[model samples]
Target: MKHHDLEILITTRKFFACDAESTEEAVKIATTEARKHLGQDFYSLEIRDPSAGWPETVHEATNPEIT
Candidate 1:
């Protein structure tokens, strides 16, 4: 059997709703919340096989709720 080297990349996104006095504060609140939660929405995935000399394949999530 031949061994091959492959690479994988995953991208995710999360949304947070915050009520703050300013945009800066809202961003801060969202960041803090994101740090506390492990849940994320899948955005895209990429896979590459160097041995095959093939272009990477990309799969993107089509969920409208992600945004």
Candidate 2:
């Protein structure tokens, strides 16, 4: 599979350059990073694996035929 996508929910929405193999794992990492950076005040988080059917970030990758 290709690189995964991760969303870290905090005071402001942010994306982690680090990617996990699965949603469960992604959340784990996000939580850890959040705790370290944003402290325990983080609101929520999201994980998207394009290989697992999650939408791509740039859009075109999801529909390569468009370009």
Model 2 alpha-carbon miss at residue 26, Å: 0.9
Give Cα-based local distance difference scores for all models: 0.48, 0.51
> Which ten contiguous residues of candidate 2 have the minimum total lDDT?
58-67
After TM-score superposition, the amount by which residue 2's alpha carbon in candidate 1 deviates from its true location, in angstroms, is: 8.5
Model 2 per-residue lDDT at 25: 71
Best by lDDT: 2
Off by over 4 Å in 2: 1-10, 40-67
lDDT of 1 by residue, 1-67 (tens): 9999876545564435668896557655655554455346533333333334556332222335554
- How well is each residue in 1-67 modelled by candidate 2, as lDDT tens digits? 7998876433454666666796667666766665576433444444444665656432111122322
Task: State the displacement of the C-alpha of residue 35, model 2, in Å, after optimal TM-score superposition.
Answer: 0.7
